[model samples]
Target: MFLKPLLHDFRLALIQLHVSAVKSENLQRACGLVREASAKGAEVVALPECFNSPYGTQYFKEYAEKIPGESTQKLSEVAKECGIYLVGGSIPEEDGGKLYNTCAVFGPDGAMLAKHRKVHLFDINVPGKIQFRESETLSPGNSFSMFDTPYCKVGLGICYDIRFAEMAQVYGQKGCQLLIYPGAFNLTTGPAHWELLQRGRAVDNQVYIAAVSPARDEKASYVAWGHSTVVNP
Candidate 1:
């Protein structure tokens, strides 16, 4: 069932999510956006990274939830309601004693299709410039994720994964035509290479790349770069 070829046009909805400290509020906002996009004729709807929680390592453990938890459950139900494939942005997932940055994918039937844990952890520090460390609290995923859709094979990658060309090549070589990345690049790095990275990946792999990011909130302590856009194959 997963190996079949899909060759057709697909309308993708990139949910420019607005994240907050309030988990419930973020979920509600995302749901509304998903419904709105589905009504507009999108076959697939996606949310940004950390859509249900604030984008900070200090807050990850506090906001972490197990799979089938509140956020995933609501996203699944919404996907079923709208009858569209849903890429449930990245969420902080708690499994046993470890926590991971995970992205959940749901089919139109509302069943979970894939849970791609972010393989690359963002850990960069430039002293006075900017410093963020995900590896300090989050565990990295061990495998790549790809799934079939009505249009083609869709690949999954979280924020930092976009910087890796080999990762994109692996997916492209495996016959994926679209790469869906739920990312939240900070203002520092976003302005420098966000669009450049997306376009570069598409041109290199000859695949469509859509990057979904949370809307920038000035009041929030951690501001996300909210430039959610897609590039052609």
Candidate 2:
């Protein structure tokens, strides 16, 4: 449904980034896209999951970095430059010898507002289809992430976290008006529940939902189902 924009509305832009193996190139491309989106009047911009690296369990450690490392530093610079609330999509984060899928948020002043690790790891096996195990290389986060903007209160999550309705409910109960999830659903589950899950969460919470995803790359090791979407209440 087309929810009409309010007089004091904010424009949210989702970048369906095409991830590559080259970490530097991916970061550069993502910053450029954020700039372009901001120039076009996006006050809040979000990137796709693992925009700085290809999606897969094997590649997590290779591309993982500290929070204040290279990737988030760029995100901070760009957010300040554009004067926008920037959601630096999910990345492979290395902390305490454990790797976690984490999403970082930055304010217009370049201050990081929140760091949400993927609370639920995506581990599923479907016979004759897709079998993936994130828990093999990644650890789960124990908290929910939320922040505030001039326009509304925002809740944050990574890909797999959207599947759990209870978490979204908690965010809703905590007075979040919008929920953002940077996801990279695979070919097997993307078509099946990607949009469905987002809609379900939005309806259940009575809020808006933005589920951003990486653009599909045919040559990537693990293909991502790229249908970045937003659902209104």
- How far in Å is the alpha carbon of 86 misplaced in model 2? 0.4
Which regions of candidate 2 are displaced past 4 Å? Answer: 1-7
Cα lDDT tens digits, model 2, 28-124, are 9999999999999999999988889988999999999999999999999999999999999989999999999999999999999999999999999
Per-residue C-alpha lDDT of model 1 across residues 37-63, encoded as one tens digit per residue: 999999999999999999989999999
Task: For candidate 2, give the lDDT.
Answer: 0.93
Best by lDDT: 2
Which regions of candidate 1 are displaced past 4 Å? Answer: 1-6
**Could you give me the TM-score of model 2 versus the true structure?**
0.96
RMSD of each: 2.9, 2.3
